[model samples]
Target: MDDGVRNTREWSPPPPASPSLVVRSPRQTVSRLRTRRTHRDWDPSLGRPSFAARDHGPKPSEVYGFVGSITTVIATAVYLAWAYTPEPCLRSLGITYVPSKYWALAVPSFVIVAVALSMVIYIGLNFLATPPPTSFSTMFDENSRERMAFSPAMEEERPIEPILDIGVVQINNLMFGDT
Candidate 1:
């Protein structure tokens, strides 16, 4: 009978997580200690803060970004002046510590080339590291999980499968097969 077949199928509830499996950390202990220390002056049973702190000024990152952008803009202006301004004008202005004018043209071009080369190298590395078309990993790997099976009738109502990794052969058959 169908019931006999169902009974024969292996069925067991997942085991409960053991105490040994639970992970404890010094960070959690330190956090608890800090909380207890902060609440020592007042009983926390009422659930109210002792004092509210006011908003601090701009964060360190915001300050850094503002300074960095200003510095870059100033440096760019100086570089442009040094590179494009005539040598007589620079001499007349009593500014002579600037480096060779040739560097201004070369440095930006070199940076552009380096960025483009880095992009190409990154794409090449990705292509080299990717699994081939015939590799079994295309179907399943250590991280691959099986899709939960459902009744054939239920398939019609469900619009999407849980997993999205459709096989090349399946796609090819779907798109180009005989009706």
Candidate 2:
């Protein structure tokens, strides 16, 4: 009747976090000291809602994105107005301080060509760095490992085998063998 197993496991609080476990910068340390940090350090505390859990308007990232989107839209509108409108129309509007119209085509064209050339250069670098097919790297070099043999009876209890590369002969035999 006395088999040693409990119906429910006892709950234990997690071990205290060591200061040495985390490396913090002096600025971050000062910032942390300056702010009153609040965390739900217990399971039960999470069940109740708090100030941090409430919706606090738009996040900083969302605000930044909104501003960036508006700025981009305004810049594009200005660029289009500058590029398509005739010189006489711009001067009539008292906006004669705009850059040469040639830049509208040249800048975008240069950016496109730069991006394409960078991609080509990256591919060429990779091709140059790759080992030849006939190189010793194709076959596992002197660092190749053999899988340790285990008794058939010990298969269930055996530890996980170390990683070993399958040889070309073994691959061919597995694929093309009559057996």
Candidate 3:
């Protein structure tokens, strides 16, 4: 190589990126656009995940306990109504409860049973219903416990603040002369 001629081999620049070259396919481009749109559309006000959306998985113990409680309550009510027919008691008091021969003691007993059963069902449902756990142990156990420990009283107390707008009322009165 001649000393006067500059060495071209060590001084080569990288080729410029072509504007026409497709780095990403059409499907990928569409998917990225859709994802951006979805993120933009989400409302910031909805703070937490819903109960149905949480990934705790199905708890068979809870389901079975609820069903069993309901069944037991119904069976107890039915037994009580059958054992306490008013006809015998009324006869002991020297008064006929139902003079009509058509209306048997069993009719009243069935009605009482149905009413008692309904009450039992309502009670069982209320007692057995468990509110879903607020946080998943794997994702947020430590953070949630720290938050809870910081505000122990807040758990028992109402979290919502009262909306007292005395300033708003004064402004309204100034605008439209107090009626």
Candidate 4:
């Protein structure tokens, strides 16, 4: 006797005349919704001016000279006090001065002279090495205005180019003859 149940191998559902619903996966539905929302908000013509393009006025580096000068003066004063102060105070703190047999008197004097020389060198270097100060008006001059106007929208967005080591690269290429 044949069982009333249909064979397990064969199964089919009747097709609808019109598609009832396009069964999208949950991820696809969410992505499609986000895309639609983004497109709706986007305006092709009305691009916002970039930070570089905007006339934000004087750069911080222009005022850095004034601050640097003040700091350098203070630093020099502190260095002079530290270097030239008496060794007696240090000796009172139980720091013994074991002078060498050959140059007992000369060692301490030499150290003091060296320290003074170093301080002078440091101060001189700082004074001589500094960039010339830009005036407040010149800092915000026409050149800066032109720079701000012509600067690209994605100036900050560009990836930093790694500093090229041509010598190293050439040496490696010569040794390896291209892998």
Q: Which numbered prediction scores highest in TM-score against the true structure? A: 2
In candidate 2, the residue pairs with backbone N, CA or C atoms under 3 Å apart (3 or more residues apart, or in different chains) clash, namely none
Clashing pairs in 3: none
Model 4 per-residue lDDT tens digits across residues 18-135: 7676576999878966765321222334465435444687778877987899999998785554455556764776756633344545666899999999999999999777655764
The model with the greater lDDT, 2 or 3, is 2
Q: Which stretches of candidate 2 lie over 4 Å from their true place?
A: 1-55, 141-143, 149-159
- Candidate 1 C-alpha lDDT tens digits along 1-179: 44522222333544657856756599986885676522233334545434542345899999999999999999989888888998889988998777888898999999999999999999999999999989998677766655556788876687676664555666688999954
Give a tens-digit lDDT track for model 2, residues 102-157.
99999999999999999999999998998899898868777787667789999789
Model 4: residues with Cα > 4 Å off, grouped in runs: 1-102, 133-179
- Using TM-score as the yardstick, the better of models 1 and 4 is 1
Question: Where's the lowest-lDDT run of ten residues in candidate 2?
Answer: 1-10
What TM-score does model 4 achieve against the real structure?
0.21
- lDDT score, candidate 4, position 33: 67
Backbone steric clashes in candidate 2, count: 0
TM-score on alpha carbons, each prediction: 0.52, 0.62, 0.20, 0.21
RMSD of each: 21.0, 16.5, 26.3, 30.4
Better of 1 and 3 by lDDT: 1
Candidate 2 Cα deviation (angstroms), residue 136: 1.5
Candidate 3 residue spans exceeding 4 A from truth: 1-53, 56-58, 87-179
- Looking at candidate 3, the ten consecutive residues that score lowest on lDDT are 141-150
Which clashing pairs does model 1 show?
none
